[model samples]
Target: MTSVWDLPDFDDHEVVHFVHDRISGLSAIIALHSTALGPGAGGTRFWHYAHREHAVTDALRLSRGMSYKNAMAGLPMGGGKAVILADENGTKTPEMLAAFGDAIEGLGGRYVTAEDVGITDADMVAVSQRTRYVSGLPVSDASSAGGDPGPFTSHGVYLGVKAAVAEGLKTDSVRDVRIAIQGVGSVGSGLARLLTADGAKLVLADVNNDRAAALAEELGAEHVASDAIMGVDADVFSPNALGAILDEKTIPGLKPKIIAGGANNQLAKAEHAQLLHRQGIVYAPDYVINAGGIISVALEYLAQRDGEPCSREQVMERVGRIPERLKAIWQESAERDMPAANVADAMAQKRIGRA
Candidate 1:
């Protein structure tokens, strides 16, 4: 078993717990980065990592990112993240979800879990049965405030893309613009629909060929091989699948002038932000652009606390601020000649009193 002390230069997390249940073949990590704003709240990612240490690393990094994300989105929540180590192709039963929920319940509300990556709203529903500290369950229940946050997240990404278009291409509309989307999952599909409605030309790619093909046919988009999507000569490259796609190797192959997507931590390393900046590519900070989900979910959490439920209008009003936030970050980047990632980090630090 790898211990926290064995990790090098790990962030100072408020709490870190390792959970295991041999009976259910469950192995997990929970990391809480902060609680200065409020209880730690973030999503739970279920992925079969190559090693235990890798899962631990992901939890720490994702939790820390959540702290910055929450602060940037003006939410009264800190950062926490959970990861369940399991084979991506393996079965994910309600029993496994309940066990994970039990682990979260042990935290006594210090950490809350939502849906991410392999986790789904149904999984969250299973988790909620074991612990009240879970969100993203089915929103049909009058007593529970949970739902798929993809549309809101994609909405913010859509607005952020337009802001990037204005700054990078000096255009007022995405109509006639070429956008290459690297994923066709929930968030990516939502973004594609919005851009398609606005008359943007789309090139889509995904590992799930059937889904991608159907979406492309529906939207009149051109489909490309998953590996070749990065090299497509589009005005924008939107990576919604996974993180670390903007590293050195792929950066050289990128043909887009704008990098904006719903993926968290799009840059492989913090320094990649500067590399993109030096390359004259407008890289909207991923955390800033992908905040709509958290904003919507956080409002739900807040409403739950106040014994009330937030309306769709109220939630969207807050999510709509993402573009304004991105514009502010862009202005700061221009004035300081700094990368938007750095500007966003500095802004988050200032909000969290680290500046």
Candidate 2:
């Protein structure tokens, strides 16, 4: 579960902590790849790990991925990831997120925080109480922002997916193409709307039944069990729920020609990309395809700190590049008989290389 990187050339990342009531559960890491560009920015993920090393591994992997994501998305910030070790099933208290906010404050302006998995706008507000080192909070007359980026994230992913579909459906159009979406959260729901508007049919499922059914009803799509989504005869498989879904065993069961979703780190291992390629499935690397939310935040940050007002159009214009990026990656992988993940990794790394 550890990344095998000879990062001897790179400086070791900084680790920080915030404890409350003698509870050290609110731990976080702030990795600065290059602040010569701007502040290190990324999201805070609250996860329940079996061991401390697992959490470390998650933080390292996510931080590195954020670096690549920012570079590819043309953002001015370096990468970082904050992880709070606690059970998501209500075991962690608001104090834990607030304490984590204190840790972000400790970073001063070195890092700016935002929402990620297992954290919400409310959680960001709690953190804002402790530090101005966070974004994605409530809006006011004094401030230009505060709201959920779910819809925007979904919009970018939807655009990326549409690009994938058009390329995927050269033999056919996406009209009535059955797409299986594996999460009905903000991202997935927004994707469903885009698909429906484009006359695409969706087979939707979520661990959250209420939201899933609501989305399905809105789009006139079918609802299936979350586990059943993999084999649902879908033309495009969207995994908006979780990551590492394209492993060895599940690849054989997937009934999709193209795979594109907002989940980070879709491959269980780098080799899984090879397996998917061998299976003839066109897979979009998560980092390349899911850069929408972070890109949006990056634009806002750059605008505020450096007088770079990234308009909504300019922000979305970056999203438009995702399709072209995917097409190039798929073409290169096919021409070279390489893994798409490697292609994406190389593409993303080139951006970091420039930095």
Candidate 3:
């Protein structure tokens, strides 16, 4: 068990809350990395971890990323994240969600929670019953509501891929470019549809073979085993699943010329960015490209504050800027001879008044 005082480098973080509800078996950590930009806003990720330490690490890393993501996207928000230690059986109940929501409410709006991996719109709805400091709820008549952020997130990533391809491959289009996608969850599936419609040849993989097979058939693309995905000789490799994919074991064999996806913390460590650059691969920082969901939810949060409904078109318009931001980062990377990840971090730090 980790205590807030014992957390590594706690001076750099603004707040960290360890929450537990015995009755509902809710164990969660809420990490607020910063509030310099605004109130901390990020998603609640539900996953089963072998040790509580892993969950704590994930919450810290992801919350800091959220802070950077918000700053880089020019949103008036700070970075925060929540992680729920769940059962492997996927038996999340409404009572557990309510308990988590209560924990979030206790923060007094310093942090806002949304849906992330292993979380859904329904889950957010349940969370909202106990706290207003939640986003990504289905649209309702009572107030401006937010729903699943997957499509918007996917759209942002698709645009980022275009920018990366143009700079990395010197191409204007994804059409006919072989793209390998890992994870066919909501965001990945949405990206597959967009890329296929744009004529990109796809190779897909998912732990859930049925999900992968279904998307492959829908896009008329090839399917590979999840473990074999990193080895595919594709023009671009998009990891839409969990973090730490671009780590030591997988980096050596990763055959893609470009790395751009919706996953947060794609790099196993900061050093992996240099490794990618050394390999002549263009690496789009995951947080920069994946800010679409937060951008949408942030708008929703504003609308709720103003007692108005969120506009999808308005959200998409803001999401469209992701490519422009990525293009600037890629250019800076070239001019400075730095990894794109480093460039992105610099950009974010500058925006957040940390540079």
lDDT (Cα, tens digit) per residue for candidate 1, span 144-214: 44488778899999999998999899999999999999899989999999999999999999999888899
Candidate 2 per-residue C-alpha lDDT over 157-182 given as tens digits, one digit per residue, 9 for 90 to 100: 88778777876777435678889999
| Residue 112 local lDDT, model 3 | 89
- List RMSD in Å for every model shown: 1.9, 3.5, 2.0
Q: Which stretches of candidate 3 lie over 4 Å from their true place?
A: 1-11, 140-145
Please provide, for model 3 over 1-355, each residue's C-alpha lDDT reduced to its tens digit, 9 standing for 90 to 100. 6665576634377888989999998999999999999999999999999988888888998999999999988889999999999887977988899899899999999998899998988889889999999887787543333678878899999999888899889989989999999999989999999999999999999999889998899889999999899999999999999989887778889888899999888998888899898888898899999889999889989788778766788888899999999989888889989999999988888887788
Which should have the higher lDDT, number 2 or number 3? 3
- Weakest lDDT window of 10 consecutive positions for candidate 1: 137-146
* Model 1 alpha-carbon drift over 4 Å, by segment: 1-9, 141-145
Per-candidate local distance difference test: 0.87, 0.75, 0.89
Model 2 earns a TM-score of 0.87
Model 1: colliding residue pairs:
none
TM-score of every model versus the real structure: 0.95, 0.87, 0.95
Which regions of candidate 2 fall more than 4 Å away from where they truly are?
1-25, 29-37, 91-94, 140-146, 171-173, 307-310
